[model samples]
Target chain A: MQLKRWLNNYVRIWGVYDMAYDESEGEGVWIYCEQEKGEIHPVSYELLNKGRELADDLNTHLTALFLTPDGSDAQELVYRGADRIYLLEHDNFNYPNEIPFRENIVKLVEDNKPEILLIGATHFGRSLAPRVAGALETGLTADCTGLKIEKGDFVQIRPAFTGNILAHISTDRCPKMSTVRYKEFDESERDTGREGEIIDIEPLEYDGPDVKILNEMIIEDINIQEAEIVVSGGKGLKDSQDFEIIEELCSTLGGTVGSSRPLVDEGWISRNHQVGYSGNRVKPNLYIACGISGAPQHLAGMKESKIIVAINTDPSAPIFDYADYGIIGDLYEVVPKLIKELREG
Target chain B: MANFSIIVPIKEVPDIEKVNFDREKGRIDRSSATSEPNPFDLNALEEAVKIKEEIGGNITVISMGPPQAEDTLRDAIARGGDKAILLTDKGFAGSDTWATSYTLATAIKKLGHYDLIICGEKTVDGDTGQVGPEIAEVLDIPHVSYVNKTIERGKDSIIVQTEVWGRLYKKELKFPGLITVTKDLNEPRLPTLTNKLKAKSAEIERWGLDDLLDTGDEKHFGIKGSPTSVVNIEVPKEKGRKSKIFEGKDAAKKMVEQLRKDLGGI
Candidate 1:
């Protein structure tokens, strides 16, 4: 089959044809190299870094695939443990749109089949992966925090039951795909001594208008992913109206406002604002939570935040145990006073 | 407009979380592992049916799981797919994402004439959201995941809204494409009584590796083909202690003082 030949060619490119033919477990794995603003996401590096270990264990060549539009250069290609980098570039891919992004990825798979594929479980990864899996008629696990090779198979480990349990899912089919959460693994230390083959391919052409990128509303606000200061609230704020206090304090302190699952449940904010295992994982310089009881599920989301500040009326609130700064007071009274003083200064 | 052939990849997952685990033994004694249509996959099926209504095409529901997964395919048929395929075989067990995607891709190619593929954003069990994109990687197609809304569908491209870097991108995507929908896409319809009966009697095609992957490379077909594996299972240590329940004004006063110290005097 053309795919088999293509795989062989790829193997030869890596100078690891023997490994690909003999040791590559299952089919092979496709690693989606995540990038933002033309720069690869750190998590992408981490994935490749970890993927290499996985590929080697399974005797497979770790392959990297980049999906970007025209005007970009594939100069950053590296083996980083990858056997090959499938470079796909097109003007349509310059900006990330689910349709075109996924379309191009699917095209690569159709052309060269890999047994497994790894994607970072970032916002883009979470948004783009499922569609591609659907297209391939396969299974996918999301936000996998761990991965490894077991008995010649890849075991995709992910948090399940609202972070209450860890589920290990495996498919009997080739190319078992899963996304790894950011910060789950360390990025491979850059070792220039290592090198791999890079393959540049023509972008897949489909007749219909590849989706138009109408607007790129860049939030000037520090991305929560990169923010050093975060002030989050929970359902205890009660209503949309109460969120003002949390927002005001955060604004005063020049920090971003985040929320626990309760806020999303209360419909006080969008899911983007949510913090927990189900939401964003943040590690900021200072994380202040007002009126959050710090449920295990909620703590699982933000425990990594460097310095935590907890304010609640309940002295026994779970949030206190994790807070570097614990306050026992009415958040209603405390937040406003804090906001006023910060403004005066 | 040409009739678009839509394929909805489905899954039947054990409600493993709901099953009580014997902590002493640390095993899922799934005497209670109830199977459900993966919540998101159900949403994918619903979206496929909705698209079928708007686009006028056959919606084929397909899944790769144990034979028991046939129940889910029948459920999809009842919900409104024109046909269904269940890719199952004893050899297809303990597959990782790589092998899973490869097998499914082979099956899809065998099904033939699929214009669009749709899937749920993520399954409840795995929650990794990798399989979809991995499949896209294997199929070599463009893919979009976590689609919030389908704004418009052009003859050649479909316009959709999805989040990128916390920002929503509304753009047109070409047809003969693939997309994964989130629960927010639409409300799923319950199966009709008559349709349920029809599905119950429907002959779901059960395809094995020989039928689906006759041309697939043996190296990439199943567990032996996967690369990554879990090193070990260590339960993350619980980070915080239970909140100490405080009572009344006295507790409130003590709390405020603690706050003053943390806030450096309120």
Candidate 2:
């Protein structure tokens, strides 16, 4: 295959930033655009939209770093606000692997010298961001919910101390980077009138590390982040086994099942299915809260849903404030009835 | 026999449940909160201890927190750490992950050689799982994040299982690499009486920026080196749910009808 051929004859620039580089200023807000299998994640567009504001504030270009195969879409990025696209096309680099991807992206960062770099804090970005930050020897803020340009610096705001406090971080270093959480901001409005340039990167002869990918199933596991409708439970569920009812409701409604931190702490559900400020910031079409008292932390995670329906026996439960519809009844009774209706529908 | 040089970089975070926000000050009132060794770091230490048990190795636990963090260091010792290093420098007060990683990496270089570095997946305080990989980069090594297990460790390479976006991947990396441990790595071993006694006498090494790094470069250690600043603090407003309460027999069906009318079909 073409990937096999390129892997053998690639070029390697090991530790390009190992030596100290002068504090030279660069102008541009760069977004690390990522894709899975081939589908471009919506977060990239959201970041591009966010980066455009920063680029405009800095009077610099808005660049999208597309490290994918050549077949990936380039038009959507420009319409979404990217002014320039740096395409690192390689057949071997279909999936975002941290090691080799870092080797390549770091090379580009060293060459281009972006002023501010924004990456979506998805599975791929989280793994890839540190390597780039490490190589560039610059500061990075992880899981940022807010990004703004104030007096010429990119200020990264994120909930710290596990949602107890927000820490505002700035990077005096070049290419101030932040891994932004998805669904925290609205996607940039698309416009076909926008235009951008796409530059192809030359082939790199770097081979994958000694570690081999034994089996990459790429299973489409359902989680809160990707769910259209989410059925969530809280401490009121009492026993972990009751989560099966939640699963049944979610499945019947054609969505994903989610839980609060206590459920996850009790090992009732995997961390992926957790919903809270520390967990996924989900923006599903419909969010069903069952027996959730709606702590401030939990509220931050799911309150942004388009429509919320809270089922709690307690009249004073906090979840009802953010919820569009509140059902004051026992979840065991309310949930099974809702499930039966959903199944019938 | 391959004895591993395993280093786990951990943090002592404020007890979040007790933390409160001061609306007047526009900042969190962290003074009243207790401190706990970040749980993720404990998981990393557990993974390190397990590797030590399976093979043969010395585990050096490291942290860059207030001197009060010595309690956390002792806890690490009580678990499985053979030695502990507390990088406490007044210069590191406001250091971000970048500066923190640089300081930790410089200290690691001073310690001579190491085969592996493990970090908790993320701290409950900062919640940024960046330091481990950042340190690897500063030290010019590869790293794996979200690691749940160390499947195998041969002479020159290690095999690990990492969860990425709800999918699991088994990775192999050469020595001198780093891996951040997830909370699921293993239930951390609680300190025993014997280990606690051993920990009590264990001398935790303390290093300031001047000891292991060039104290002159303000950009390498603390707030001077930190580029980001917390310009604003916003405490999310607590808006209670709808005050309406419908009770008795038909409440479930009635709620469903209202939900369907207002929220639309699922």
Candidate 3:
């Protein structure tokens, strides 16, 4: 029995090797344009922008798979750099449903056969991308921060092992798919003169057991990712109430209030305000770290800021190493002083 | 109400907090790190145990890892898992999320019957959050990700609240479905002394790739079956700054001046 099993494995390995080397017949770079409430998510444009570069490198057209409700137009996607738009219109597309979206996407992917596919790493995309990849039996790299066409290979780069290591991955399968985090790449400038073909496709009718959204509550908090300046607090704060100081400083700077993971885990602040590898990645114009010791995970989210200022009583704090300017003083003293300075100035 | 059978897939990962990076070598020093059950998976197990306690059912915990992962499965059993199965084999090494989910879905198929499959939002090491949904897709069942609360459990369905893009959604999913839970679900509980003792001596069921071949193809079992491969790994180099340090009462003032000069006023 052992020998038979070994033989089976050997044969299967060889079979897989043969299949892996088969040249892909797929064409074009595709971006899954996610939409909500009749508006295209901004990340879709970002993907289109990046997809255009990849498609250009491969000398192919950039295609945007726009699934939206009836009456929505795909012209904006063309303006964003898409050479062709495959628009699927359905009333069900107005809200997010995993099964129908997955079914339709899987069918489209099977029929069109794009060489590369990129989707936003938003909550909706993360849930939908994997199911589509699973149905197609293709590999998908999640939350990719970088993408490149290296020597005709579609390379997907993402942080792994708690953001300490960056892994560059390549797929040996067709329709190489990746989910890129929003804000990781810049969106292309709108070009009204750009021309593209819009092909409206029929949506798949899914009658399977589906998830029904009973209630939807849109959160009304400041999106820290879009903030120009961010004032963040960390474990250095003696108490949760000290967040008030952070808030004061943030408001004085007309910025958003952010916190490290520990504060969010402690329930002292909402998860939306947390900034780190596991939280919202922010690239604000100015970032003030109050009492943050600067763990690698935290740095991964905000290190791209144009200016970083660290305030910690400990001069040896790791945040100081990354901060453009460091101040060695208690946040209680320095923060209040800064708030006063900003208010007076 | 009839009792429901719950299956929770957990993973053992390197202790993220204690993981050491050899910056010069551009690699992680795995030898210096201790392994622990992925924290998010613990939340999954806790939710499963809570569901079983409320509805009176069996909870089976499954994990795919090396032989050392048995310890993690034992830990799960101690925490409230009724039965633990470890999917360990040399052939399973180097499996990415696709192959891993396929193997797990195959093992789940061989488990006969289950009402629900619960998993952590994502593993700390990979942080992909793809396996749970991928497994559901392989099994052809409905799933919800980032579920934070269970509002109601009906005879044939479950109502859950999930968070997506800073929005809250209350969704109801039919039975025989899957759900990936977030950290906000519930606080995990410690094991009793009796349960801890029992789990220590418990005989964990071990299933190798051979055991799952009846339901899954051998080509889809490991690296050979994986569609994606890592071509290179790099440790991001830390960019140095001016590191101008200031102190005393006027420190804040001096820092403001420097920021104004460099940034053209804050």
Q: Pick the candidate with the highest lDDT.
A: 3
lDDT of 3 by residue, B1-266 (tens): 44678999999999887789887887889888899999999999998888887877899999999999999999999999999999999999999999999999999999978989999999888999999999999899999999989999755788999877467889999988999998888999888899999999998999999999999978888998899999999887767777778776687777777767776655
**By lDDT, is 2 or 3 better?**
3
> What TM-score, over all chains together, does every model reach?
0.69, 0.90, 0.94
Q: What does candidate 2's lDDT look like per residue over A49-70, in tens digits?
A: 8888888888989999887765
iRMSD of all candidate structures: 5.7, 2.7, 1.5
- Write candidate 2's Cα lDDT for B1-266 as tens digits: 44678998878988766677675676767788888998888888988888888778899999998999999999999998999999997888988777888888888887877998888877777777788878888787878888877888765778888766446788787888888887777888799999999999999999987887553343467887665566667665544445444566666666667667766775
True contacts kept of each: 0.32, 0.61, 0.85
Predicted candidate 1 versus true structure: per-residue lDDT over B33-97, tens digit per residue: 78988888888888777777776778888898988899999999999988989989877776766
Candidate 2 off by > 4 Å: A1-24, A151-153, A162-166, A190-193, A207-211, A340-345, B214-218, B236-243
Residue A345, candidate 1: Cα error in Å is 7.9
Which one is best on TM-score? 3
What proportion of true contacts does candidate 2 retain? Answer: 0.61
Worst 10 residues of 3 chain A by lDDT: A15-24
Local lDDT at A305 for model 2: 84
Clashes of 3: 0
